[model samples]
Target: MAKTKTQTATPAPHTRTRTHRALLAAQLSNSVGDGAFYVTSALYFSRIVGLSAPQIGAGLAVAWGIGSLAGVPLGHLADRRGPRGSAVLLALATSAAVASFLLIRSFVPFLLAAALYATAQSGLAAARQALLAGLVEPGARVGMLARLQATLNAGLAVGAALGGLALSLGTRRAYLAVFALDALGFLVCALLLRGLPPLPGAPAASGDEPRLVVLRDRPYAVLTLLNALLLLRLPLLSLALPLWIVQRTSAPGWTVSALFVLNTGAVMLFQVRAARSVTGLPEATRAVGRSGLVMLASCAVFALTAVGLGPWPTVAVLVLGAVLQVVAEMRHSAGSWQIGFALAPADRIGQYQGFYGTGVPLARTLGPLLVTTLLIGWGVPGWLVLGAVFLVAGLVTGPAVRWAEHVRSRAAAPAAGELVKAN
Candidate 1:
């Protein structure tokens, strides 16, 4: 709250000359399906299809791993063929993959279905991000991203409620109905993309440009790695803290639900407002650095929960930690958006965004194991070490992004000289 007091005024979404109401509407529709499918996927496989827990888990792990690897290539495709058309085609393809689940039963079929779904989902995300980059001005990007996050939360709530209603019916037909609706949602999203302005394919860069620019950009790679670490904040809230409360802390179990509500509600209310002040690279990097400090403070507070306090005292500390982590998340996310966009070459944003997108699914894939091991295995010392990690990473972000900018400038200089000499 104190950090974002110096915000530049940004236009309201409705006021912009953009017809992104369709895009926002598409995100809302897609996210609702995501929430429902995610919540019901395991149940659908377990109860209706009769697959065991370990079977589904292994398949999903493999699928997500494969999908993460595909992001770079698929993103390159988007750059070559225009994100608008690629996004539409991929979204429709994803819809077909989702509907295929109705026939999957055993391990092999399930694995194939999961792989197809996961790959399409990852590609769609990269395409949509690239599409968004083409759709909105850079200055307004973070605010729009913030609004999308908020919309996702709202859609999740609605979809979760729908899933609950479906679950209460306890029939195979009921589960199938949810799956069908989720597929339909994607189809609708594809239709929505058809209405957006055409985004022309990016022209190939000069032969002097590195063949695989994103892969060779070492500084951006480091920045991507750091962002991956910061993304651990998600698993901390979703996976680790809940289990920690049950296993280690004296806090009442209800704090789990309460803390999640706090995190979600806070983001819904404050994320866009917080992102407003971060309109450029310098401010973006500072916000990223501050997020680390806030995260460190949050971790320290969470560690206090294990200090043999009464349940109420423990609950208070847990809530405070939750609040701080959410603030840290909002700050870091805004910074990430700014840096990611500003650093990418305008023509190859899709490829670069795909490269950056790898960090997220990779983090989601690995974070659960890492955080649980550190927090649950080493206890308070572990939490302190994690805080130090956040502090160091956050503080390093600005320098790293600036260094990346310098590298880009150096890379472009020779090309500029070549063109002048030819003239």
Candidate 2:
């Protein structure tokens, strides 16, 4: 992709239109429920539902795997039937799944409910993205996404606190209440979505075109894979860092909570600002490239924590690493939003967004095992290798995006000529 002319001035920051407010409200409502569930779900399953830890983990793994496969078809449904309706329906389905969890006692019932939950959530995400793309201007979509991210973190924080209260009580009633709250949140989300302005569905594909056209788009597939690789960072803080702190560093276990707080608080405060300058594809790619280098530096700093430093010194170094990591995270997120929306075919935005969104679940599913093995099992060398992986993935994103653009341009050329002749 040759450099496109950059905007000379920064655009005014995104203001909360009614649609924006509705979207943010829906996101916050559901995320709060999700946050509470995240903190309580494991114990709920073990203590209340009588499942073994291994059983819980295996069931969730299978659920998300199936969810990942279900996204594309569900997103295609959004394109054919309108995004707002699809999103609303999926939200209700998600609520139903959460409600079912209250009745699930056996492993098989838990697995089935979990799968439904995951699938509905995945489809809901894709439909929401498609709705965002339709309603928001191209230039402001990233800004809107940044705001949504901030709202999500805020809601999660509040939900986590509520979940902590439930954990303190440690009763079956308390656990059930958390699940009930989560289900209610999704119900509210659906109601909010129902009020949004409807968007027309995409036109049907011509007879010659495949029904699932995204499956055949090789360049976009490559882009999605590269993005997924960069997303390995998703589990680093959640899964890998706590283990690294406890086993590898002199830092106290409390440092894990501190790091989590730092991450969520920083994102809530700064994510929108970090995304302000990413006005177009060129800027977006540059931001992604910069994020890679920053992530590499953070990784290197983390590696230093294992060098027999005093506890305070390890904590200080870990804090610095975390700051760098969060900065990288914000920039990468901004750039990703830009690329994901810009490169997708306008008519097929629902399916394309669904496919692109798969990177999240993929990262979540595979990242823990991979990151833990590299960081915990291999030690310092693992950190360095992981940094290199991030660096390469970030650098490769530029080429992958350009390849996608080139293919899109080539595909559009004949269409333009045919229009010219018809005129």
Candidate 3:
């Protein structure tokens, strides 16, 4: 996306600077391969490697856990070192981890490789976000983030198509090709980073070394936790909705694909427009609150799906719900980018971004279990409760963010005074 926003809200692809365009292109390439490999991984493990579905799940869960733990330290490393170098290194590590799947014949090796992959992926995300914060101005960062998200959706769609085509080939080697494709994309992305200015490694003005500033800021930590739950929207659509449609709702099975198409299409077509209002933290907080209300309505509509009105009625309600959910998704994501950037100290953004990014792996890891228990287990009541959580968390964000900024300012006062005295 272009740095300038007003007249052309959605900049043409050619308008962005070379480094900015390259980063966005790398995002698309990486996500395409991820989309393909993700679809194939479970089947490959079960059919080719002789591992059960649960074993595959266990390995992935463990990997994500490891990834979460590794995030902060790696991010701190990026803050000290250059983010450009760290991002390139971890991207290469991610490629190696994906390629290791080719050697997997048993469970132990698979688990080890997966842990490495997940950890490297988490570190890569932290480093990349730091890179963005350094390269992009604060005023334009959230918009840039939304534009990248749109590219990711587009890339995933392409990847999914390719994966389906490969599935038709139906050979073990064909599945392995999917993995190889994902690895190659990472290498490409790493190479692209070589052209980026070593932006993340901006030299820090002398300030206290951060051991765990993010953790100590209780309000900020709380916001991270709440945002993590709000992100359950992802699992709700990708995993729970399909299961709910099949078992509880009277909606036709194919409706699931329709919902995915609508959500993906909305994100690709309108994510930047949705982000325009969120250029700063106050606006972002409002957007988040608005998203919460949308989510509440969507969940309530979804609850109606189980009433069994008829296939068409169920389809209507489900489609409506999906549309609202996409709105919520767009608003929540844009708002989050602003909040994360606003709350982080400029000098320690790599560490703070790393801390903030943890919410993703943490949410993705717990989201399935949470969705299954709340949405699937209890049915209607579960949906209502989920809606309530969104409502509360969304509204709470503004106050929480204000309080975090207060704490951050208070903490910085002593240092400022000390500098003044030295001068």
In order of listing, the candidates' clash counts read 0, 0, 0
- Using all chains and alpha carbons, the TM-scores for the candidates as numbered come to 0.92, 0.96, 0.93
lDDT of each: 0.84, 0.90, 0.86
Which stretches of model 3 miss by more than 4 angstroms? 1-16, 200-210
TM-score, model 1 to reference: 0.92
Query: Cα lDDT of model 1 overall?
Result: 0.84
> Candidate 2 — worst ten consecutive residues by lDDT sum?
1-10
* Best prediction by TM-score: 2
Alpha-carbon deviation at 375 in model 1, angstroms:
1.4
C-alpha RMSD in Å of predicted model 2 compared with the true structure: 4.2
TM-score for candidate 2, residues paired by index? 0.96
Give me the overall lDDT of model 3: 0.86
Error of 1 at 109 (Å): 1.8
Please give, for residues 82-136, the per-residue lDDT of candidate 2 as tens digits.
Answer: 8999999999999999999999989999999999999999899989988887778
Q: Which runs of model 2 end up more than 4 angstroms from their true locations?
A: 1-16
